[model samples]
Every structure is written in C-alpha cells, then in structure tokens.
Target: MGKPETVRLVSKEGFEFVIDYKAACVSNTIKNMLSSQGNFTETELGEIKFPEISTPILEKVCQYFYYKLRYTHCPDVIPEFKIEPDIALQLLMASNFLDT
Candidate 1:
C-alpha cells in the first residue's frame, strides 16, 4: 500500500507531532490550514506550526483530536476527558485558537 496520509503539527518550542490527516482535521483551524484556497506553506509542506501553543498543550490537543475522531460515532458510553487544573486555562486558550 502507499504511504498513509499524515500531517505534522509543530508546537511553539518546535515539538513536532506527526499524526493521521483525518485526525488532524478534527480541528477546524488545522483543516482550514491544510485545505485553504491559498497555497500556504502548511498546505504545501503538510506541516502546521502553532507558534503560541506550547508543546504540552499541543500534545493534549492532538490527543483530543484523536479521541474525538475515535468516539464521534461510538455506540458505547464515552469517558470524560480529563485535564489538570493548572493547564486547563492554557488548554482552553489553545482550543480556542485551534477552533476545535
């Protein structure tokens, strides 16, 4: 089979996350960046750089993306997504930025 469709998301500190394209598109911001009409660097390179989001926050966002995709149509009960109180604000800000 051919290579799997994936996209790279780079955090503010240059932490890179390579994830499935479908999973990445769970975020409206990422989806637009990858599918925008203009030929931006992200679209060309299949990599998006989030300059304001920290590595830890980005990682959590990626996890949420996958979690959303996995359980969007599940028949079983979905578990609550936990977040530490300290990082909750940051995560919320990042999620707002990502438009997830």
Candidate 2:
C-alpha cells in the first residue's frame, strides 16, 4: 500500500486542516509522530490530533509550515511570518511545543 501524500491535523475545537505531508513534517514533533518508529495509528492513518492547540493557532501553525518550507533555503528573500497580537502568546507556546 502507498503512503498518503497529505496529513490531517485536527485542532482542539474539532476543525481539521489537511496539508501536504512534506509541509506537515516542518514541525519536528509532527515529523517524529509520523515517523516509522512513531505511533502506528498516526503513521498509518496520516492524521494527528492536537488536543491542546486551538483552531486559530493550529491554522497559523499550518501556514507557518508551508511558509518555512518555501523560504528556508533562500535566507535573504524570506518574508516575515506574522502573528496576531492577541494570539502571539498562544502561538509562541504552540511553536515551542512543536519545536518548529
């Protein structure tokens, strides 16, 4: 059987975001979770649940993953990854946890 090319990330509020597998792997935590030695269910199903991460924050994290992947190699051309002032704290905590 072929592995999925995308992964589903479900947020605390039950919102789901389907992203490219490569993009999802931007987060070290997620990469580990989907690795061959990681949890069998997640690796097989291509789905991960973030019970502690809110919908908005999870969406932002997903966006950052693609953004990072797009710009990681070109240092000077990378644009700023914006975070809303109100959710800055929460986003920081999530980023730290994901080790992105």
| Local distance difference test values of all predictions, in order | 0.90, 0.90
Candidate 1 overall lDDT versus native: 0.90
Evaluated at residue 27, the lDDT of candidate 2 is: 92
lDDT of 1 by residue, 29-73 (tens): 889888999888888788888899999999999999989998999
Model 1: runs farther than 4 Å from truth? 1-4
In model 2, the runs with Cα more than 4 Å from the true position are 1-3
**Per-prediction CA RMSD (Å):** 2.4, 2.2
- Model 1 clash pairs? none
lDDT of 2 by residue, 1-100 (tens): 3359989999999998999999998999999888868458889899888999999999999999999889888758667888889999999999999989
Clashes of 1: 0
